[model samples]
Target chain A: MSIERLFIANRGEIAVRIIRAAKELGITTIQAYSEGDADMLAVKLADESVCIGPAKATESYLNINGVVAAAIEKSADAVHPGYGFLSESPEFARAIEQAGIKFVGPSADTIERMGDKVAARQAAEAAGVPVVPGSKGRIESVDEAVEVAAKVGYPVMVKAAAGGGGKGIRIAENEDELRTLAPQAQQEAAAAFGDGGLYVERSVKSPRHIEVQIVGDGKKAVHFYERECSLQRRRQKVWEEAGADCLDDQTRENLCMAAVALAESVNYRGAGTLEYLYEESTNEFFFIEMNTRIQVEHPVTEMITGFDLVQEMIRVCGGESLSVSQDQVKKSGHAIEVRLNAEDPFMQFLPWPGKVERLKIPEGEGIRFDHFMYEGYQIPPFYDSLIGKLIVHGKDRTDAISKMATALESLEINGLKTTVPLHKALAKDPGVASGDFHTQWLEPWLEAGNLTPENT
Target chain B: MAQVLSPLPGTFYMKPSPEAALYKNPGDPVAVGDTIGLIEVMKTFIEVKAEFAGTFSAYLAVDGVPVTAGQALAELVV
Candidate 1:
C-alpha cells in the first residue's frame, strides 16, 4: 500500500529529510508550512505546498485538526510528522488515522504507553530489560519517597510520571532534600502535566548517554547497533557518534539485544530508539526511556548501517515488511554528528534567530550537511534553533574526529551567532579528542570559561 | 501616529482566547505595559505589551495573522 501522496506535517531540516525520502519512493509530496515558513526549503522542494495556518507552531504544526484537514483536502494518503512537534503525540496520530490517512508511525495506543516515562519504565522492566533500581512503583507521598530513597540509597532522582525532555526532574541528595523536593516536585508535575504521580530512580553518576536504534515490522524487530550521545551541554546533546569505542563486544551485543527485546515486548512498529544511561566505570547500563520516533542523531546510525531510516519507516508504514534480517545488518567505519544551532553559546545559548546573509556549507567526501539553511533565508525566532546537522564518516574514530575537526573549521556562516565556536573549541579539547568526557563534562567545561573567543 | 510593532515572529491575537472579547479596540485609551494583544509561538503566548501610552488607534494587522518581528501590529495616536 504505497502511498500516492505524502503530507509532511513538520518543518525545518526534518521536513527536508522526509521530502527527499518520499521523492525516492516516487511518492508525491505535500509540505505543510506556517505563514512564516512558506518559503522553507522543503516547501520549495516538495511537489506541492499547503499553508496550514499562522506562524505559530500551535496553530500550524501542532494543530491536529488543521494538519488532518490539509491531508484530507489535498488527498494525501500518508502523513509524516518527522520529529518533535507532534511526532510522539497519540492524539495527533489518532486524528490522522480517523481521517483515513496513514500516520507513518506506531499505533496511537503504543505511543501513549511509551510516552509516559513511568509506564515505559514498567514496560521495559516487564520485558526483562535492566532498569535502574528505585521505587517499586509510583510514590504516593513524601514519606513514601523518603522510604524509597532510604532503600535506594542517596542521590535519587525524582521524576514526574508523565515527564519528557527532562521536565519535572529533581535530584535529592539526602533525606532532607527528598522530603523538601518530593512535594514540590509533585505540585510542579500537577501544574505542568496534571499528573501528580511521581517516581524515584537511582541516579547514575556521570553516565554516558547511549541509545540503540531499532526498527520493527509490527511483528519482529532488529537493532542497527548504538550511538554514543555523551557530549552534552545543559543536558542537551551537541556531539554524537555511532558504535562507541568504550564498550566491550559482549556488552554491546547484550545492550542491543535488550533494546530489541523491549521493542518486541511492545510489538513496536516503525522506527524507535531505546535510550540508556551507561556508567563506564561499572560497565553497567540502565534503561532510561524510549523515543518513539526517528531521532535527530539517526544519521550517525545510518552512516554505519547503510540504511535510510526515514525511507524504511515510510516503507514499513506502506505495509512493507522488514527487508533485511539481523545477519544482513552490518556496521562499518565510524560516523559523528554535530548539531549546529543558531544560538550564542556565550550568551547562555540564547536563540540568535535572524537572516543567514552568507552561507558556505562544508564539502568533502564522507561529509554530509543535513540542513535547511540557505543564503538570505530568515531564521524565525519561533521553533527550534537547530539550523543544521553536520555528519561525517571515516574509516575509524580518529579518522572521523580529524575529519569532523577539519569540517568544523571549514564551515562558515554570517548574520547570526551559532554553536560553531563552542564546537570548534570542543573538537580541539583533549577530553573530547580522546573520548574521555562524560555526559556532564561539557557544562562544567563551559563554566570554566573555555568557550570564550580567546579560549578557543 | 505611532505604531505598536510586534517584537517577535508569531501569530498576533486580539483576544486572549478565541471566545474572549478583543483586549483593546480603536479609540480606546492605552498605557505603557498594557496588554494590547498576544503573540503566539512555540505554544507559548506572550503578551504584546504597549511600550508607549497613547490613544489606541486601529490595528494595522488583522487578528490571527502571522506577523514578523518589527511589523506594525496596531497604530497608536499620541
Candidate 2:
C-alpha cells in the first residue's frame, strides 16, 4: 500500500518541504493551491498542481470539501496535510478516509480523542505520564476551588474550563487569593463563553517550554529526544533548539520514554510532539498537550537525529513498520532554528509582504534554509507572515549559536523587511548565549530595547 | 471627488464581521479619521480611515476582494 502519488493540502514553506520529501521517496507530488497561490513556489515545484478555490481561505485551503475533492480528482494515493489548517482536523481525516485515500497522519479516532484537553490529560495519566496536579474536573464554587488549591499547593492557576487564549486565567498564591479570584474568573468565563466551569492546576514557576518528538506506526512508537522552545513572543515560538541543554541525562531519558509510552498507548501514527512545562529549579516536567501532527520546529529535531521525519511519516502511514529501533535512533550535536518572518522588526514586528527582489542564502555543511521564496516572488498577504526558517547545526550548543550568528550575517532577502535583525540581536545576546531564560523572558527582553539596530 | 486608497495589499472587507453592518454606505457622511473599511494583510486587519471629511459617494472596490497597495477603494466628494 505504498503511496505512489502524494497530494499536499497546504501552502507556504511547509508545502515546499512536503513536496521535497515526497519526491525524495519517488512519490509524485500534487500541490493544491488557491487563486492567489498559483504563483507560489510549491506549485512550481510539484509534479502536478490544481486550483482548489478562490483567494479566501474559507473557499480554499481551509475548505475541507474543496481540498478533498481536488485530491480525489487528481487520483492521489495519499494526502499530506502539512501542519496547521487541516493537519489536526478529525473531520478532514474522516473525509479523506471516506474517499478511500490514505491520510498521512493518525486515524480520525485518535485525532478526536487527543484533541480534547480533558481526554488528553486522562490518557497521559493512564500512560503513567506526569500531568500537572489539579482538580479532577470543573469546580463549581469558590469553596471547591480552595479545596483543590490546598492540595495542589499554591501558587496555582485558576482557569476557566471553557476559556482559551489566556483568557479568564488568574494566579493565586494562597487560599485567600484563590477565594477572591475564582469568583471573578467564573463570572468572566460565563460572560465570555457561557460556561462558568473552573479548573484549578498547580502553576510551574519559571517554566521552560520543552517538547519531545515522537513518531509511530499505529503499533510501536519511538522518541527523537526533546526540543526547547522557551524563547517566544505572543505565544508563538521565535527560536527553538534541539537536545535541551538545561536537562540532565537521566531527566532527558525519562522524558523521552514517557512520550513513547503515551504514543504507544494510543497506537499513535505519524509524527507527533508532546509539549511539557519543565522547571529547571525543581528538575520536574509536566505533560501539557500533544500536537497531533508534525510541528514547525521539527527541523531542529531532524538536524540532531538525522531523520527525515516527513518521509518516515509518509512511509509508516503507507503501512510500513518503524524504520529504526530505539537504540539505533542516536542523536549528535546541537541544532538551532529561528523563524524568519516577513516582518519589520524595528516597526514593532509589523507584517511586511513585499516582493523578494534578490535572495542570498547561506550555504555550508550545517546551514539549511527551508523556504518557499525566490527572486521576484511577491509574498501573498492573505496568509501567515512566516517566509522561511533558518536552521544551523554544530558540535554543541555554543558552537551552534556561533554558527547561527554567522549565518544570520550572510543571509539576505532584499526588498523586504524581515525578522533577520531580531534574530541577529538574539544570537548575540548574553541571556540567549548562556541559555538562561524562561517562557516569559522574550517579551521583557524586547521591551528593554535589546533589538535596536545599534545593538545588533 | 477624492479617492480613498488601500494602504496594504490584501483582502478588503466593508464590514468588521460577515454578519455586521457595513461601516459606511453610499451617501453617508464621512469625517476625518473615520473607518471606511478594513484591509486584511497576512491575517492582520488594518483600518482604512478617511483622511478628509467628505460625503461618501461609492465604493470603487468590491467587498471581500483582493486589492493592491494604493489602489482606489472608495470615492468621496469633498
Candidate 3:
C-alpha cells in the first residue's frame, strides 16, 4: 500500500532528506524528535511533529516504544528509520511490523539476520561469497577462540557479533594479544550492543574499504556500483567517492556483481549496502559486512548515477518496483564527498559546538552541500559532531579533487571550529588526489601533525 | 565521603521527571546501587547510582545542566 503519512524515526539531514522524498511522493511527513531537536529543521519541515522525549537518545531516538507510539499517534502508514540511532535495530523494525505499520526498509527478519556480523558471515558463505576465513560462528570460550585463532593464523580480528558502523572491532597480531583483547572486546560489545558474542576473522592488511549499494524487491536486486571509502579516520569514513579509481573495469564489474549476488541470495528488499575489504596487494576482495540502512555518503553514489536513492527506497516500500534494472543503471563522471564536522581537527577532533555567527557556503558547478545548518544554528552539544557534507562531481578523479579543494576553500563557517581545514588538507594531499590512501591512512597522518595550514 | 559519577555525558536530572519526586536529597540515606540522579545524552538516560552507602550531602552538578562522563553529580558523607 502506498504511504499516506510517513513518520521519520530519526533526526538531522537524513530526516530532512526522507521528508522531502516522502513529500515528493505525495505523502504527508511526520517528524519524531527529542526536546533538544524540537527546533531543528526536520521538525520544522514535516507536516506534523512530536517530541518523543528529552534530548537523551535513549528516552527518544533509541526508544523503540516511543518511536512506534509517535508513528501510531500520528496515524502514519509507514516509518522510515534513518541511519544510526535505532535504524539498524531489528527489534525496532519488528515493533513497527507488529504495530501493523509499514517500515520503509527491509523486513525485521532481514535486519535481524544481517545485523549479527557472524550470522551474516555464515549467510555469505552459504551464498558462495568470499568471507575472511575465521571461526565458523560466534566463539563462546577463550579456548574455542584460541583454537580458531590457531587455524586462522595470527593477525586476526576479534569482532562483536552484532557490531557495525566501524566500532567494537580489535585486531591482534599474536595469540597472546588475542587472548588479552578478546575479553575486552566482548565486554565492550556487551556494553554497547548488549550482546557479548564474539567472532574472529583474518585481518586484511591496509585493505581498501569498498562498499556496493544494492536495491531489491525481495526476489531480485540491482547494484548501484560502489564507493571507495578507504580514506578514513578512526575506522569512520571521512571522505567517500563513487567508483574506485584504483579498480580495473573487470574488477569493478566483478565487485558489483558480487554485491548483487549476495543481495539476491538473501532475497533482500529495500536498499542495503554490502561492505568489502579489497587487499591492494592481492587485488582480491573479501566480504566485510553489510549495512542494512541508507548511508551518510550516499550522495556520491547519487551524484554519479543521478538516482534519488531515498525516493527509490520510499517508492519501493510502497510496493513499487525499482524503476530501473541492473542494465538500466548508469554511472557518469566521478564524485567525492567530505564530512564537515563541528570539531577541532587539530585538537584530536574535539567537538566544538556553538552557534555559527557567519556562514559562507560554496556555490559552483559540481558542488553540493548537504546540511541543515544556517547562521545562528545552535549545534546542540548533545549529539554527533557531523554538521554537513560537501559533495563534488567532475569528469574524473583529478577534476573532482580540484573541484572539492576549491569548494572547501570557498566554504567559510565562522564562530566555531570545524573539520573543514582538515578536509582541505586532505583534498590537497598528493596521495588523496591520486586516490592512493587506504582505510588506515588518515589517522596516523593526523597524529604525525600534518593538519597545519601550510601542509595543504 | 563519596561521590556519584555520571556514567555518560548529558544533561543531569535530579528527578525522573518534573512531576516526579527527586531521587535523592541532602541528608537522605542512600545505599549502594541507589540512583541519585539521571544523566541523559544521545537521547539515552543512565542512572547515576551510588557506589557506597552514605548520607547524601549535596548535588555537585546543577540540575538540568550538561555533565560529561565521570563528572560528579552528587556528594555523599558516610
Candidate 1 DockQ vs. native: 0.31
What C-alpha lDDT do the candidate models reach, one value each?
0.89, 0.95, 0.86
Q: Who wins the lDDT comparison? A: 2
Ten residues in sequence with the least summed lDDT for candidate 3 chain A:
A346-355
Question: In model 1 chain B, which range of ten residues has the least summed lDDT?
Answer: B39-48
Error of 2 at B51 (Å): 1.1
Among these predictions, the greatest DockQ belongs to: 2
DockQ values, each candidate = 0.31, 0.92, 0.17
lDDT of 3 by residue, A1-456 (tens): 677889999888889888888888889999999987878888889999998998777788899988998888988899999899988899999999999998888999999999897789888878877888788778777778788989977788899988885557999989899889888888888888898888897888888999999998777899999999988887779999998888889888988998888888888878999999898776778898998889999999999999999988887887888888888899999999999888788766766766788999999888998887778787776778788899999999999999998888889899888999888898888888767778888888888888896865
Candidate 1 residues B4-59, lDDT tens each?
88877766889999999898888899999899998865345778898889989888
Clashing residue pairs, candidate 3? A56-B43, A56-B44, A57-B42, A57-B43, A57-B44, A58-B43, A58-B44
Whole-model lDDT, model 2:
0.95
Give residue B54's error in model 3 in angstroms. 20
Ranking, TM-score, top scorer first:
2, 1, 3
Kindly list the per-residue Cα lDDT of model 2 for residues B15-72, writing each as its tens digit: 9999999999889999999999999998889999999899999989999999999999
Candidate ranking (lDDT, best to worst): 2, 1, 3
RMSD of each: 4.6, 2.0, 7.0
